[model samples]
Target: MRKIESSIDRRRITNRPIAIILAAAALGLFASTAVRADDSVGTVTQVNGSAQIERGGATIAAQQGTPLKLHDKVTTTDGSVTMGFGDGSSMALSSSTSVEIEDSTAVNGQNVPSRVTLISGDIHTIVPDKTGQPHSIEVNTENSKATGPSPNQ
Candidate 1:
């Protein structure tokens, strides 16, 4: 019985380092997820023809899986483009359209507002309906500004 107790104690002592390592790894994974959440406000799902994304004065070709950040100006030439946002919102822009992302942030599972400026062209936006949780988004056109689909929508 004494020998068995000693073995058990040794096993428990050895397991402490493994437990600590596991905890540290879990914490790292959580932190990485938090970092990844801020990486992009949305993503480019499809680009029909030619689209350009101007970020901080640098223009890049927009393609599938391209990450979109805040203040990104996207313009579509010959064809249209489609984008999916973080807060269950999607936007489809027709050809000869220009849009700028004003603000978008996803933090700690909170629903925040996003703003977009439609410099030109036609766009169809869809925001999810979340009854009590109010999620608001706004779009600005050349002449007027309008709110997107609210929580009721």
Candidate 2:
């Protein structure tokens, strides 16, 4: 009876550490999963390149390879600010316009939703047909949100 009890106690002790380790590992995985890249914002190909973008009374250049985020104010000095999307879609920010790359994501690893908020300016875009899934392109103005050209248009 004594030996059996000892074995049972040892098993319980060993299982506790295993369970703790597994829990820690799961938390680590969850943290990493949330730190993914914002591919929908795509790459900046023209920062301070030629067009001077001013935000908050500061002039910042929009260059290629810059990772844009939400609320990053952007404006064009001479030409339009261009941005590429993961689904081959793109947007051109008109001069003297303030645009923001709001919420964008490639959810479920299936389709990407590229959202842009034009606080006060104009945006021209080219939407793509991504496979069979419905791709979304939303543009928000001061008073309204507009969807891109219809799927058939």
Top candidate when judged by lDDT against the true structure: 1
**Per-residue accuracy of model 2 over 1-153 as CA lDDT, tens digit each:** 455334356778879999999999998988877665333356565443255444456666777766555446676656666776556766767666677666666644623435566767666666756454334444435433445446675
- RMSD in angstroms between candidate 1 and the native structure over all alpha carbons: 5.5
For model 2, the stretches where C-alpha displacement exceeds 4 angstroms are: 1-40, 46-59, 107-113, 131-153
Query: What is candidate 2's CA lDDT for residue 134?
Result: 39
The worst-scoring run of ten residues by lDDT in candidate 1 lies at 131-140
Q: lDDT of model 1 at residue 132?
A: 28
Model 1, residue pairs in steric clash: none
Error of 2 at 122 (Å): 2.2
lDDT of 1: 0.78
lDDT agreement of model 2 with the native: 0.60
The clash number for model 1 is: 0
